[model samples]
Target: MCESPVRHAHSLLFVPATRPERFVKALASGADCIIVDLEDAVAEGSKDSAREQLAQHLPQLTPGQLTRTVVRINAVGTRWHEADLALLRNWTMHGATVMLPKCEDAATLRGVAQKLGDGARIVALIESLAGLDAADALAREPHVVRLAFGHLDFQLDVGIHATADEPELAFARSALVAASRRARLPAPVDGVTTDTGSAERLAVDARRARAFGFGGKLCIHPNQVAGVNEAFGHTEAERAWARRVLEEAARHGGEAFSLDGRMIDLPVIRAAEAILGG
Candidate 1:
């Protein structure tokens, strides 16, 4: 049920939170961000143990590592969410990104913001009908740096038995992208492709996501990272545009400036950084 990352991540690879053993391996998997998941990846009986194990190892990552790593907590209604929030509230994580699953509105984000208090960056997952309906509100939340299309769960929620061909979810994906752009957030993160073994399929999905204005794709397997990254990689024109954006931003002292009528703020700056590998 987890969403995506707030930071500019081209490929966010998920590693089960219960399997602390795989944490290091995930870090070395070449993903732009490695998300330690405490949601679907953890069994109901093992939620607490997963949280505890995650809390123990999460802070061990160095500052640089923390930037590229995130934690996907349980959804709001789950029994594990409160404990998950408590763990995050009390921990000494230096700049950990937290992925909020089943985000249906801004109120939930406001509550989370009060608890985290600007200590974390949030990625809101629009999984349910309520979430998709409230996508604009979720995007408007101050702590939410990005939105993600939880395509699988949404399809389940809507009773659609569609495959990863993704035509059925086009409207949903487009809505998310529009919401994100209107809110001046980074381009939304697309849902993961389940066919992790098929690099060709993964690349196709990644390209489709990019075409829909998504900035990145989630990865269930480390093997999918490179393909996703390649699909979203900057073209020559993108690199040139990024250079221009940064230069114009710098000229205006990096404040809320503009270049070619597009507002240049933190999200745009982050996107530019990603393009130039800044």
Candidate 2:
């Protein structure tokens, strides 16, 4: 698989494709990836105009900004899906990223791969029971770079009335993470925190995602970027510990050892490497 810029993104911010003026600003919002949303963000009647807006303004972005940007097309079975793919033809050839919403099967992703060809990178959004059940298959798709949780729609689809903390979705979150690991993909991205105005809520959500082994959180607002970034990032103390662990491992010739009364084995060494690697 080709390297994906969003593979380790900590914050994926959404900007409505209809609002082209905000594109540059969203890219500058310190988000690791900016998702240009053409799915839920655009009304049914405005889909075509939204594509037109993107066609006109997307080219204005610098190559670097475009590299960090992802275009979220309508779901596979939606009326606008084919048109969205058509609009993305040139962009995909130039190494653009695409996020497929409500991805429930490998065949759908295969179809997209055929359309986007080799240059495009795909993020599969799991939002329904069908999607959750097929998470393993979806993750194993060669073109899929990562899996993302769409918790809001997922809850509705499964008739789950989850609370703010959303403990009910734990199983689904773990399933995605496991599937990604099995497929050797980066840790999956977590769903968005709908309460955009609450910094505390965003922080809690981002941190909770990190605890669940998610690499990133989706954000509807630019304000949520810093919180997500901080949550996914390692602290100075964590870096120091990771460095010490590696030094000790080297001294011990990569064998198991004890550090601060805790066993520093292969698993611990790997964890330390991941922390320092990021």
Candidate 3:
């Protein structure tokens, strides 16, 4: 699989491609990645303009900013897909990742990979039933590095109206996470929180997504970055416990030991290491 920028990103912020002025602001928002959106966020008539605007602004991004920037282009079958791909293939250093929305097959991704070459990396946004069916193949694709859940569009397509708690999407969430792990990909990214003004709801959603084994989440606004980052970050208590677990395991070397009345072993130490590393 190709390298993934999202593999290390805990908070992904979206900025409208038409809004060039906001590009620098989004990059400075403390978000791990900034997605310059030319899909849902841009009006149909303005797509060409937004595309041009993005090309102009992208080359201006500093090297440090390039690694944190992503471009969310239109779906594969759309009118803008070819043009977007052309720009992406040519502007290799503009961004580290590309978000391919509504991916339902590997063929499209294969074509994208071929067009973008090895320099530009891609992430699949699985948002439809076809996507759910093809996720395994998508995750295993050579150029496809990570999977991201697009819950709002997904629910609308499936005709499901879920409550604020999100219990209805549980099975789907678990399936994607399992698929990513089975394919040895980074934990999938959860969808965005629509409640931009409600930090309470956003934090709740972020925490829920993190518990569901998601490595990161999409942020529609700058303010959501802090909460999403915090939700995914290891707490002081978790870090302290992980340190202690490692210390005890080192004393025993390769053998199993008991700590705080609980068993400490290779599997236990590995889990602690994951927390510390994250």
Candidate 4:
């Protein structure tokens, strides 16, 4: 498996690549990563034109840019896959991460990785029921650097009731989290909240995702970026607690200790270090 640099608190903003007018605006939207989306956002008739637009604009991106640019290509069984792959083969961008949607199995991922040839990274989109079921195997693929949940499509596919709490989708989220940890990848990212202007709702959803072990989230609009970043980022209180936990554990010579009258175990210390980015 190809190793990637440890991801920071990233806010991945999704934009329709078919709309050339929106691309520049999305690039300037204060996101850590800008996803040039060719799937879900683009209409059937616009896929060809979107591919053309992406091909033309992909070359203009320079290295050391503020945003990490990626292309979200269509699924393997779709008509756009061949053209998308062909376009990506020649496009020059800084560390292009291919967002493979609806990734069902390891074979499909291996096929894409073979084409990328170590130059690009793969972020597997585990959307459907089958994809969730095969997440562990898919994560084992050498090219898959990140895993993102596709909540909207997943809800429809599994006939699950969607809510802010999303009790029915909990199993899928847990599966992805476990798979990511098993593969030693960064924590999986949560799906998007389509309500663009509702920062309050976005904050709530972001917190829920964080509690579920997601390291980051996908955003449909720029307005939600700050809230998502804040939700995922460590607060001063968390960092302080983590530091204190480590100090106490060290004094005990790696034995279990208690802080603030609460018992601190190995898992607790590890979680604290994770939050502090140690």
Candidate 5:
């Protein structure tokens, strides 16, 4: 199987599949993963053209770039969905990942996975109540490399008009995070900020996602990449704290100890190890 590009991604930037010219630029933007989106970003009338352009351009990428590239096909049951998978069958030979939008059930994901076959990985985008309800099963799917919240569509699906901070989406966010953890997947990726005009908004949203245990954020613009990366990455202070915890834990011979006036137990030790590993 192909290695997953998203396991440690702090930022996943989306580029419209029709705009092949921007694909290389997006990869160079320092985003951890670049998603070439055919769903939502590509209009219905332009879907075929977008897929053709993507087919022509994908083989041009180096294997390394292909590993970091994610092609977001239309949701299952859509007219374009089969064509999208058909195109990928030939083009993803270098192990590029796929993002399945509006993913809601195991059978659908499993069918897609079987179609893509070995070495194919999927990032499941949970966008509706059905998807949220199926998050646990979706995360447990063997080929699902990551789970991402599509909070914008989810809000529309759930009838919650949320502000930028999205307090209304707290339950969904927590559920996704918990599901991913229980499935032993990497922390789930939070949805896009949507307000690309405000760097502060992006930073705040990214940080908020991190606070909720998300390992990454979806970026709609190249400019948002840096902010998302910074927000999800561990700070020097955090690294220092992790280092101290490890050193003290070693001194205590892996026994529970006190650090910074707080009890350091197995859970705390594991958290520190994760920070330092990142």
Candidate 6:
């Protein structure tokens, strides 16, 4: 199995695969990862054309490229699944990860895993109530490496009242975080902010998601990428505090220690390690 890279403090920017002109520029953007989206972003008639275009560009990426590449395919139960799988099978791209949308069970994942063999990785997008309920089982599937929340579809599926604060979707977000932790995966990715240029609003949303234990946030535009990265990356103060707490604990023979007069223990150490990408 290929081990996933330690992805602390990174932005995954989504680009519509059908827009061939956007592909090179997106990959060249400073974002840590580029997700060529074949779902939500692409229209019905354009899906196959997008797949073919992606196949042509897949080989153009050189070794040791700075940005990691991923493909967001349509939901498993949708009509697009077979073509997406076929494209993935014949491609020779390096470090390609598939983002499986609307994943609701382990069986669906097992099928994809069998197709990808053991070398490829799958990222699950938990979008519906059924998928949220099945998250633990889904995460345990052999091919799944990460889980991401699909807030828009989730809201529609659950009939949640829409608000800027997203109060109605809080439970689903919490469930995703808890399930991801239980499955020992990296922190689940938060959903996108539709506004392309509103950095202040994006920062607020990103910070809120980070507070809820999300390690990353999705982006609809390149402008949103930097803000998401800034929100999720460890602050200097955080790094210093983590180091102090660890050093104090070590000095005390691995016993609990006080940092700024607050008790710090194993959980604190683990969280510090996560932030520091240790």
Top of the candidates by TM-score: 2
Instruction: Please identify which of the two predictions, 4 or 5, would achieve the higher TM-score against the true structure.
Output: 5
Local lDDT at 227 for model 3: 95
Of the pair 2 and 4, which is ahead by TM-score? 2
**Cα lDDT for residue 262, model 1?**
81
In terms of TM-score, which candidate is stronger, 2 or 5?
A: 2
Q: What is the Å distance of residue 46 in model 4 from its true position?
A: 2.1
Candidate 5 residue-wise lDDT, 1-278, digit = tens: 64667777999999999999999999999999999999999999999999999999997898888888999999888999999998887555677889999999999999998898776689999999999999999999998999999988998899998875678899999999999999999999999887889999988888899999999999999989999988989899999999999999999997999988999999999999998988
- In candidate 6, how many Å is residue 169 off? 1.0
Worst 10 residues of 6 by lDDT: 1-10
lDDT of 6 by residue, 198-267 (tens): 8888998899898888888888898888888888887899898777777777898878877887888889
Runs of candidate 4 with Cα error greater than 4 angstroms are: 1-9, 91-94, 247-255
Tens-place lDDT per residue, model 3, 1-278, is 33445677899999999999999899889898898999999999999999999989887888778777788989878999999988888665444678899999999888888888777677899998889889999999876678999999889989889899999999889989998998998999999999899999999999999899999999999999999999999999999999999998888888998888999889989999999988
User: What pairs collide in candidate 4?
Assistant: none
**Model 3, stretches more than 4 Å misplaced?**
1-4, 93-95
Assess every candidate by TM-score: 0.83, 0.97, 0.96, 0.89, 0.96, 0.91
Per-model tally of clashing residue pairs = 0, 0, 0, 0, 0, 0
RMSD of each: 6.1, 1.2, 1.5, 2.5, 1.4, 2.2
List clashing residue pairs in candidate 6: none
CA lDDT, every prediction? 0.83, 0.91, 0.88, 0.81, 0.91, 0.80
Models sorted by TM-score, best on top: 2, 3, 5, 6, 4, 1
How much lDDT does candidate 4 score? Answer: 0.81
Q: Which residue pairs collide in model 1, if any?
A: none
Cα TM-score of candidate 4: 0.89
